[model samples]
Target: MGIQYFSQVLIFGSFIGLLGWTITNQVGRTQLQVKSREDWLLDGTGLTIQGILIPLLQATLVYWLYQYLLPIQQGYLKLPLILAFVISFVVIDYLYYWNHRLLHTKLLWKVHQVHHTVTQMDVLGTSRNTLWTSLLIVYLWIHTLFLYLLADPTGYLLGVSLTSTLDLWRHSRLIIPANTKLYQFLSPWLILPQDHAWHHCCKIHNYNYGANLKIWDKLHGTYYKSKNMPSIIGIPSSLNLFQKLFFPFS
Candidate 1:
């Protein structure tokens, strides 16, 4: 199990590195500008202990509930390992689109603002978040439920883990070369740096709220395209760390 887990981690790390390298090499320089050191500390920094802990806590809690509380034994829900991976991936990403959109709503934006508050993009930026947002969000619950139902936690974890690699690439400060095969292959399906860069380009326009693919944004009218993109990204509010950390409530 350890070997398999380590191998998966290695693969994900390599993929992010490859994508990040392509991006950095192609973009000439990172378009994202750092506005303030205070801004960097407040939002730009990656997963703190709290950020990492919350996700793990939520995933584990949901998984354990399904294992012990749910009636899996009443009817066997065993899925072939391969099929489990496919089902988990499809359902999780599909649900993630809606989850991402709802997080932008008036009520939740206070919590989600901690993320968009970052003025620049980096791998760690993807991991930034509030603890309360993690357990309450539909997307995390979907992931936990899928893992518990399939009875193959390994595949479930593998599928969920793949998103981070893609996310890291999307938030990277690098740019994909216009001429690369990987660039061409990844452009249509995955949320590449350019896609997310456009998202952060505006506060209201070009939300581009898809986590994995463009299908949802295209299906809905939220998609925005343009010859110009914003040079800076962040919410309009001027909250400090303490305020942001306890936002929408505290």
Candidate 2:
């Protein structure tokens, strides 16, 4: 319970902090000012749904479903702290790599395309997607499943919080210098802002689908190596507000 509380604080606090930073920074301010009302509607709705409603649904409905299905196995998996962290940060990351790739496929692209509509790297646009898109994301189910199974979920919850925090950071314009030692160390393993920017690029959206790590994409040959930000980001979308919020498909 304590760890869960801490994780919630970490994730929400990061969002608030990033949001404040974005609004205050000159470039971020300009980006926000140029946004259309429809963009705000989509991004605002998406953030509310993904940050609040979806989490509530995950905590209640999905967690309850798991409890019913595995009543006898509640808290059965007692892994070491490091192993549990690895499962969430490494193992599940691999799974999400494929899951993300799957969303890009023709069948699921409509559902996921809303997320790619952001024209720039902004934390506010990170969760922009159709309302029901959360249902297709593996994190909604898998994270709850692991939380239900782990007797001591401290490490796993830490990984989850860190991943959520990084997700926000990578989507924002708060990029680290590539020549810095920090970037040098993290770039080889983690997905940096520039790396994810290319993923949302209008030109090369097919590559860099990994969430937490680049190794998955590198191993699978989907990694797009770029030291600079993409010239053009986001695909053009003609969907109206209603279409974007509910059904993004044409």
- Of the candidates shown, which would achieve the greatest lDDT relative to the real structure? 2
Candidate 1 root-mean-square deviation in Å:
4.0
Please give the lDDT score for candidate 2. 0.91
- Best candidate, TM-score: 2
Clash pairs (backbone) in predicted model 1 = 23-174, 23-175, 24-174, 24-175
**Which ten residues in a row are the worst by lDDT in model 2?**
241-250
Model 1: per-residue Cα lDDT over 1-250, one tens digit each: 6634763576457555754564565342343243355544543343553344545765577667766877654225577766666665666677777888888888777677777765566654665665355655665666656655654456656666666556666776566675789877877666677678777754542378887777678788777653233587655667766666656556
- Each prediction's TM-score versus the true structure: 0.78, 0.97
Off by over 4 Å in 2: 248-250
What alpha-carbon RMSD in Å does predicted model 2 have with respect to the real structure? Answer: 1.2
